[model samples]
Target: MSSNRRIGIIDIGSNSIRLVIYEINSLQAYRVIGEFKQSARLSQRINSDNTLSREDIQSIVAILKQFQRICTANQVEEIRAAATAAIRNAANSQQIISELQEYSGIRVELLSGEDEARIGFLGMIHSLDIPDGILIDIGGGSTEVSLFRQRKLVRSVSFPFGAVNTTRRFSADGDFSEEKLLSIRQMVREAIGGERWITEHPGLPMIGLGGTIRSLCKINQKKHKYSLPLTHNYPMSAEDMAELMSWLPSLPAEKRKKVDGLSKDRFDIIVPGLTILDTLFKESGCSHYVISGAGLRDGLFQEAYLTDNSAIGMSMPERSARNMLALHSCSPMAHLEQVASSALTLFDALQQTHGYDARARQCLHIAALLYRIGVSMTYYQFSKHSFYMIAHSRLDGLTHRETVLCAAIASYKAKSRVQQLYAQFKDVLLETDIDVIVKLGSLLQLAIAMDSSETQVLPVRSAAVTLDKELDITVQTQNDPSIEYKEIAALNKDFKKIWGLKLTLLDASSFSTN
Candidate 1:
């Protein structure tokens, strides 16, 4: 399998068309290289007879042609294009696809409502660590709701109405009378009422996809001055969503655009979109709404390009951490793995003293694996670069607090430097986290020193806290480990200060004989 491959995914949605190019690395870890989107509003172009107009068909072809050219220029090896809702529901769907293929030289895969729901579920499952939830994606002309348990798709349904056509139907006069709101709410409730599975799963987190959900998350983030700028895994309570929906209708059409975090292009359709979300929230009695940045396009990319499922059993944080290592680290995998193993050994051995939980252990492990990722940029102050990269990259399955802590642990040069970094993200972190970071940071530093030679020869044979408030570690080494001893000696001051234990090193053979 090729280690580096570029694939392009073009999504023909009813409200917009988008093309995203991804660079997939050897480990099947991917990142977006280029993204382009244009709002065509194809749903509004459908005639009363359920067929798209010839002019609209030409418009679709034109957009695809441009996307094809962009893909060609990027040297994309494979291009996967799919159409949903608008083209799939149209009576002349086959004709539209034929013309698009003939003119654009890209075969369009018209995804069915069920297929869209399933693919969206695939994207969500791979990106998020949530074991069970309700997935909702609201496009321009259709809405897909799927229920999953244990990360497997259970039931999915697609509603024929979406933000675009719903707005056209009820708010055509540009007036949201109380009657119109009621009608819209009633219609949404009635549409989803038939799906008993949605109502049965009360209090499960509702994972949302599509533009409307993203916009909602942004608006909330801006409103509260959220500390983290990330949108994925952003959580909003049902009450918060209800509050936003309630306030949105009060604003005049022109005034709504002035609100922060809302895109100018989505101004007209946002209200209807929110209404659909609000309806889903109330109907399902969900505990909270989490935004999923990955959706159908990501799902398509994963299905077509990613073949490695070896990381399936790993936790989300570990899997994502490994991916980051694969993508960015210039160090040998064996060296990194050794460092991580030593860190974990020390963590487990010292459990009786620090008493940190598994979460802290996870952070320590991830930090150990990625501490050297910054070497790819520059060796000088690489820890700082590593801190910047790990803190910024979507380390995927980690919470905001965990991600920050991992960065702090990886970049640990001194207690002072870690403290300075913690000050910046205090909003997401607890004051006590400083202690966790320092302890784990020291452990990581010690772990790196054990493998400073990068030969994985000196392994921690055993570690234990003695009665005199001293940590004694035995290393298994055939040859003299004077360099490793020297590195470990340097950390004694900070380690004792943070852990309240004097550090002692013992050779495995010497300790057994004694």
Candidate 2:
């Protein structure tokens, strides 16, 4: 519940140990300040009898101690450590957990298969605006599948089909032959066959989480020379996935290291990971899938945040937007609120003239919250900075399309830079969408100009739209608002160009100020 403190989350899985440190602004407003991971691979060294080898225990202890030093150096205030399937399935898990606690001074909570699936689902639902579909998390020791409709977790199941285990069990020695690949596919099918919910929700997009899925996107992007470097919400087609799977199995671990985006250490396990993903795609009939960068650590953060904050069930977008603003801005929250309020007021009053609907209004609201974000970088050309930040930043609860629109609208506040920046994203946007962004940007410019002091205490009494497509804006003071009026007059030509509207300032001294 403290502000500006660092909280660390540790995830000990079958293949790796990872720690994520987050800087908190409030209970729900935080950002990842640091992260570290090491491939301990305790699952790979587990004896056939299901007991951890002594060498495995020593390696894990060393990794945990290294993680502790990082946490201590970063002044981590609290830590929540969890161990997943590898430790859960081990016969000596209890003794290992005890040794970890006694020697490392960190408590280890073991997560069940169902709990793991739920946590992955939690991370995905809050990170993506996905309302329905099958969520798949391919881990080292298990694969978790969860079904959600409407933003809530519905049903989840975990299976023993994992990348590390399958690799050691079936494809350890050489390239995957046709017969071996077929056996692996059959195994996955048998593990996931009877889930009627997967068939019931036909055509819903698949959202994938975990390191393997992200690595696949990275490799594909590198091969295709994709312009964007972002991995979150990166779209991949089933055909594209199949193409990569076909070629990847043939590349030995040494050759795989030569690939542009594939990490050297992940070479041995990637084949089995891709094989499982390919099978899942075929079984679910999902045409394409989106990658989620957040997973179990993010879920733990959100759960911990909600327990301390009053905003437990708020819509993810609004909460995420506010958190983003809080993390980036030193400006007064009141100012941002006023700008958003004024922009929405203008949007509602001009709906008949502009003919744009609620979605446009939502974009306007987001742009208002972020328009000045670039000021943190440099006051000069701040709107351009805001545009770049919104485009590049991982804003939760917004789709790729919405992120693009928001960035366009925010950039237009700079006025002179609008056309240049708008042209850069032409491929991703339609002409009509660009037109709407311009219209909304015009309204936002007017709203921002009205609060001349950058203070929420503007003496605006009321605003009215007349039938002749004119806006009569009334301010409470009679001491001429020369600056405000001039700002509106400066944009008059463009405003009329977009909305066919005339603007006039009404004298509030002739009537009640309130």
Candidate 3:
């Protein structure tokens, strides 16, 4: 509950209006606290003259009022609401915006197609560490495709064709035909082909946003019975998608509603959505797609928190790790920092001894920071609890394997053996990886013991590792420092077994002369 403030963001899209409330502790620390979504399909209700129908306007007002009430109940400090494609293209957009503002006491900013594409792209980049990839946001009224390389947004293009619009254009009466499907595919192909940049990068995977993509992912998860329920970075292959696309259209609308991942409300629009994805897969030559649950709502939240574009293209796994610690652990942050600092230094100095890469150092640092998080639950076998928490927690910018490795290391530092953890999580981690965790965990154990004095004011004079794998460490202290040395010496057996090295601790206090 220790956080800065709770704010609400409402994204009024052509297909749905969604409200997400975020509890923000800092620029790096924020999590979704409340969410409500209603499928409006406003774009399908627009009249031929390009004006929002009165029925759609009334429905929008009702949904906004409900959102306002929820925000009030949650005591949200501020609200950021924006309307996309449908509102932007409507001739009576200003009038409807004013009326909705008066009714709900919330101003709705209309976002242009380009703005929608950019914001959706921003949201995907900040949450997922895809160094280079294409972003696809299939909305109710429009589809925004953006390209990024090396974490920077390079190009963006918005096609004025989306699920709801395409559905209405081709098949609106619950009728299905191959001709209709082909026409939808043709439209998507033409629209995407106009943006030649999508094909410029051949093998980069595509990250997908919007309701349709999430629904498809959910269905896939239900079909596969995947262990993890998270959808943020769920990956789906083109072949599997092609199967879903081929099978979904054959079902009756009512049967589609009963499908595991397909929502009842979206049954009618799903065909077009999948068709668009199929064409995109062909045009981009990408075999897999990652589903991103965060979209414009998260973009609005980040924009408000950062107050600038600083969070746009940067990858902040370290920051995300710190924030995850801040949210879960009840231990003091200073203690965590001390352990992490010492762990990283020890890993760096003993690299030649351990022969692990930079990634191993990252695992050690994260483990040290989260080593005591399990104490929040109980002191008894806290390492086991820590493992469960890390495996389940939202630690971004790390792969599933890295997350398991970090959890395993934390378990080792908590007194569980690396072999035991490897046996438990063998499906996700390798035996060699387990060896690396044990080595890093041994180093972390020494670091934590060095700071067991609790003050962390003791200076480490120097640390050295010889080519023959002998590690000599000297610390400055006024006292004999016997307790610290004894604590570190306890791990000497494992250290020697794993790294083929002898660790010797020395105190400079006894040798110094004034």
On lDDT, the leading prediction is 1
Which of 1 and 2 is the better model by TM-score?
Answer: 1
lDDT of 1 at 17: 98
Per-residue lDDT over 215-248 for candidate 3, one digit per residue giving the tens place of the 0 to 100 score? 9999988897765556777788888798898898
Quantify all predictions' global Cα lDDT against the true fold: 0.87, 0.80, 0.80
Best model number under TM-score = 1
What stretches of model 3 exceed 4 Å from their correct place? 1-3, 26-28, 173-175, 308-315, 378-380, 413-427, 457-462, 467-469, 478-483, 511-514
Per-prediction TM-score to the true structure, in the order listed: 0.95, 0.92, 0.89
TM-score of 3: 0.89
Cα shift from native, residue 57, model 1 (Å)? 0.9
lDDT of 2 by residue, 1-514 (tens): 3457888999998778999998886544678999999987676888989999766777788888898899889989888899998888899989888888887888989889898988888887878877788888998888888888898888888887678888888876636788888899999988877765665666878889887898899999899876556788888888889889889988877888888998877888888888988888778877688999988989877677545555467555567777778787756777788788888888887777778867678888988888888888999978778888888888777766677778888778544455565566554556577677778888888888877666543455567788877787766644555666676678877777777878766656654321
Q: Against the hidden true structure, what lDDT does model 1 obtain?
A: 0.87
lDDT measured at residue 4 in model 3 versus the true structure, 0 to 100: 69
